[model samples]
Target: MAQECRIPHTVLCPARTPTCQTSPYLEAIRRQLAVRTRRLNDTGALTPGPPTASGQSDDPDTHDGPARPVVQLLLCRYLAEHAVEHLRCVAQTRHRHRCPHPIRALTGPAGTWRLLPTGPRRGQLALPDVLMAIYDLGHLPYRGQLRWRAQRCPQHDAAPGAADLALAEWQPFDPLLHAAHIRTRLPHPEARRPGSR
Candidate 1:
């Protein structure tokens, strides 16, 4: 019998999901694009079009099937929504639990991942500016597992110390390090002050 997954959060988070297998169509496109990119590099040519697709599509949105990035974005949105629906709110504890506001995807520059206002009111600010997952683990040359971080849930801003004190308890995932943890680890004035006693 399969072991019951006691912690659904670990298996369900976008970071824990299995790496996507490349589809044959996309692989073919990738190879074609690679060759074209190399050819263009050799000839030093510049044009305004999808640099990644060789006539496969003038626009990635009109392709035969949704591209990998598009699919990944949809998956991220689904997971974010699911987390807000099923998982406990970041502010929840054994004694106190507060329902979380819905999670919303924000758009910004390339590789931007932000969770902002959850309500459905598209305006100049509500639209997504980028396409990426909320989390990304980078492999730096010397750094073991450190990487850039994404925006936190806006609700955390209300509590005076919630941002700092509630970090370790924010999410169930072990590898998902919060910004507060980083700040806490750095030297603080209180720690360096000389004892007056």
Candidate 2:
């Protein structure tokens, strides 16, 4: 039997009733992008999650996917996202119930993740500078009132100066977004504090 999934702040919100609030296609896209771009080895193999047609090794432990520091950072970010996204947001238990906002933090450390202005204007401070500034480290990606998106996700479609590549073409590369994660993890002064307590 399928177990029931509980979501927080959404108990009052109906499930499977249909709403722009949730779109399966968007979720699918998000997940697909996450898989193709977020999960991979430095050599660009499908090691973090499963093997692709590319002949990379199938792996469940993300940490073992990459050896380079940058690769390690990228893998950690993806692993954290996978962990948070799968959490039970609908649980009634105070300790267990949580939204997805801290996810941003988990995506990377502080400042590593930022909000860009969005509106009809060329450039305006339409959005707040810092969001969900709270939450403990590793407990990042707390669901906020808003969601983060790129020009498109999967970079193959949305990132600038990036080309859209098919799964076959992507057989050996991860997302540039993962680069941001890598850059953030460096011991540089620029590294943002991990977005958690």
Q: Please list the Cα RMSD from the true structure of every candidate, rounded to 1 decimal place.
A: 23.5, 22.1
Global local distance difference test of model 1:
0.28
Model 2 lDDT per residue over 89-185, tens place: 2212223432223223344343232211111223433432211111123322432211221111222222244432211111112233333223211
Candidate 1 ranges with C-alpha deviation above 4 Å: 1-34, 37-89, 93-95, 102-152, 161-197
Clashes (N, CA, C under 3 Å) per candidate = 4, 22
The estimated TM-scores of all candidates read: 0.20, 0.16
Report how far residue 14 has shifted in candidate 1, in Å.
29
The TM-score, computed over Cα atoms with residue i paired to residue i, of candidate 2 is 0.16
TM-score of 1: 0.20
- lDDT per residue, candidate 1, 1-197, as tens digits? 99884534433233234245655664565567667765543332522244354655343322211121111131222222132112223444234555353222122112222322222222423432322223221221221111111222334424425432123222222112221211101111132213211
